[model samples]
Target: MTVYWFMMAWVILFGILAQVSARKVCVGEYLGEEVYESRVHLFVAVVTFAVIVFFAGARSYVADTTAYIKMFNDYPLFQNAHDVIFDSSAREPGFRLFSILIKTYISDNYTVWLSIIAVISGICVMVPLYKYSCNFGVSAFLFMASCQFTWMFNGMRQFLVAAIIFSCTGLILKNKTLLYIIIVCILSTIHKSAFILIPMYFVAQGEPWNKRTLLFIGCIVLAMLFTSKFTNLLTDVVEQTDYATSVEEFRNTDDGTSIIRILVESIPIILAFIYRNRIKGKLTPIVKLSINMSLIASGLYVISKIASSGILLGRLPIYFSMYNLILLPWLLRNIFDKKEKDLVYYIMIICYFFFFYYQMEIAWGGLEYASKILNVKY
Candidate 1:
């Protein structure tokens, strides 16, 4: 506990230092691109690694880490990889195999493996953010500081996959058709819910909030809500199979986080909708893709929780995080003239951070409890 407090102070002190240095490089008149990029990347890498190590290491004391911790020691794969994956009926076969490989090959250190996963997710987010920032000469560091980037670091495996798939969506420069197919195929392996995003490529190309778009969103929500018989069908496939029921148990244990994220994370996205036309011209194809994904993800989140026992819609908000991190920077860049509105930008960011803090506390029980135990007084 003392170490936790010390670590928290250390992180704040160093974080401020990094932020100051980054701002100097980013907001300067003589902006040397190379210097700015390196400084920002180093700061992000350092802070990302520190946060993961701190929370994940103290997770038993600070967060409800039992679910993730279980994956580390469970070598269900090396012993029965094929039976665990193919003969089984769960949609998470890709994750199952990946977990097995981690258990088999990675150092027995659970924290190390989780850190690696976190780093991968963080880097995935950086790719889209970088591309979007490059498209319009905005500050990448400010973009990184968005709630989406930080919120995702705390989400376990589901967000990791979301980050990867969402980033891939943003990076579709040329050969978009091939990129779309490949990313969707990859994401489906992690969570079948990702399959829902495939058609969004076409949907994103259309105008926002159109009659057809709203109707389609309404239909998917209705389907998720009224389609429990289909979900039950999914469950039957599980019962008939011989894979461990353990994964099912893990998937079903919701802890009430997803529901909270759906309501909370959508606030910014809702704001985006209100300012749609203003941002429409400013937003690039990838940025537009992200916004569309966030909207569909928001709709999915409404009824997705019905199957939390087997699947969850709560994670859909992460699609918002992926899109909005870059989108917010673009929006802010457009709304406020850069030279004079830096303070306003900071204020907006501060308010958004408050939103993120409360959202994560309500959504993730581990974080909720940690805030309480640390007596941080909110």
Candidate 2:
């Protein structure tokens, strides 16, 4: 709790400084409307990136950190590498190769390996936020308060790939479909779940609430209404994948995503709906895509709550939920008129603060970070 508390505070401080020190730039043209961009301060990026990467990298314990460390410790680096990476039963060749290279050339200290991964994951996420986020401070707050930062602490393999694709968001706005798919395919080697982003790329295109977006919403409805059938079909699909054995461990056993999270993640889209007409004419490419992505994320959360197999479906939302970091601040700034703005911001701050407390202490039972370099302990 000590380290996570410090990390969140540090990021929020620098996140505010990032906005204070920002410069505006044009990213690209969208339908002849100039796509405005905010260039996040490099110094702030360095500070934020350093704290996040360090705390995450230096961890010796977390939900899955020990498991990851043990796996890295046991990897067959350069010793029968083929058998290890190319075994039919094997997967995530990219992560395996990435780890092997680090062990072969860099220090074998698992901490150093974790640090390097933290560097990659942190940079991938930071660069995109640096480029795309209209309000760095607000985005940073959401990034932490919403518990998206847990990905770095818990699921490095998939989050690494997700971060990589997230940095390529400019490609989506540029309408580079083939290139985006190619990039996703390459990243999928690291985590097969990266394949999920392929369809999402198309869904993110065009205006908000388009037919594709409505169809995605319809699927969520269908998933909720026919949970057992959805789970059965999902189970059949999982049984065919590498996760077949994992499915046997538990089927629709874990409790669903909490209602609090659904409400928190739903805030941006809720505001968007309220101000739909007000913001329609002002929609930019990045904001539109973010709106759509936020909707997808909220819909996934709904499915995760109602569907039989909530745990499996819940993880899928992170791929889209990240965009809420971008969309939420924009809504707060643009959707509300000036008179109602300060009140909205106050409500937001109060809500997220309590939510963060609940999530950190009550839900996770408090986070503990241990690091020899920093002489920190749980």
Candidate 3:
């Protein structure tokens, strides 16, 4: 417990330092035009590297970390791409082929594979986020504090796919249809869920309060109210896919979405809606996408509440919810006046700190295994 709190403190301290460093570099710049200097980028890169290394090196701290290790250890070295792609497993071919290729040429060491994944995922997430966010420091901090960083430890494949999709934020924002489609198609080979975002790219770019937005929101609400029935209807179709086996048991489970997660994700959307007029004019394509995604995530949470198989469906929202890391900071910067921005920033820091605390301590078993990376145990 002591170690967990200490780790959290370090994360918060680094976040504060990132914000301060960004401010120093942008001191003379106009409001909302602060560019992240090369030094600031270096700081971000170093922090990201350190965090990824910690996660990659961790010893069974997260539940799926051990499972992934087992999978890598058990994976066979395929002779060719054809063999790997045609393997009898339900796992996506992209990652399957990647695993085979890595094991065939590189070391079969699971830690090495995990480290590689950590690097790719980190770069994919941070690069786009830095490009799109109004404040790099706050966005990075939210990425960690919101538990999205920690989530990568568990859903490695899904998060990797999501990160890749996130990297195309620029293409989507720029409305480069052909480019975005190509990217999403390539990424979908890693995880089929990436296909869902194909239509969402256009949906996200829509006006916030328009008919289309309201119609989608209403549909989401309707789905929530009849989640069990809706899930049952899809069970047959879902069962026919690779995901069918995985989602089979969840078909009848009554598990609901996490209220804490819902609250954390919804806060930015709520703020955006409240300050729509003030910030709407300032909404960049990236910001617009973030807001739309947040709404979709919130709606999914509501659906997750009533669906017997809600937990399975909940995974769909994560691709969007993660963007809150970028959205929250952008909204804060655009909506608040200079006088109130500091107060709001501090409040957000405190709130997100507790959110991280709850995630690591109360929710995820106190990060008890985190110290294992340092060969220390409580």
Please identify model 3 stretches exceeding 4 Å from their true place: 1-7, 23-39, 57-61, 80-84, 234-237, 251-254, 368-378
Model 3, 1-378: lDDT tens digits are: 564455455656665565566533332233457533312455654574365445545545566677778877777777645765786665587787787787879878776687778778888887876565556667767777787775567777888888878877777767789988887788777878778787776667767766667877888777767766776765665566546667756655546677787788899889988999787556655677788888877776766665644446667787788778778887777678998999998899899888888888787767655434467654
lDDT of 1 by residue, 210-310 (tens): 66567767776666767777456544644443223533665546432355556544554676788786666555454555566567666656545555531
lDDT against true structure, model 1: 0.53
Query: Model 2 — TM-score against the truth?
Result: 0.93
Which residue pairs of candidate 1 clash? Answer: 257-363
Error of 1 at 222 (Å): 7.2
Please identify model 1 stretches exceeding 4 Å from their true place: 1-50, 53-64, 76-82, 134-155, 170-175, 206-264, 302-311, 337-347, 360-378
lDDT of model 3 at position 313? 62
**Candidate 2 C-alpha error for residue 241, in Å:** 3.5
Pull out the clashing pairs in model 2.
1-367
On the 0 to 100 scale, the lDDT of residue 114 in model 2 is: 92
lDDT winner: 2
Q: Rate the local accuracy (lDDT) of all candidates.
A: 0.53, 0.81, 0.71
List the candidates ranked by TM-score, beginning with the highest.
Answer: 2, 3, 1
Tens-digit lDDT string for candidate 2 (263-362): 9999889889888988887777788999999898888788767754455667777888888888888788777788899998888888888898899899
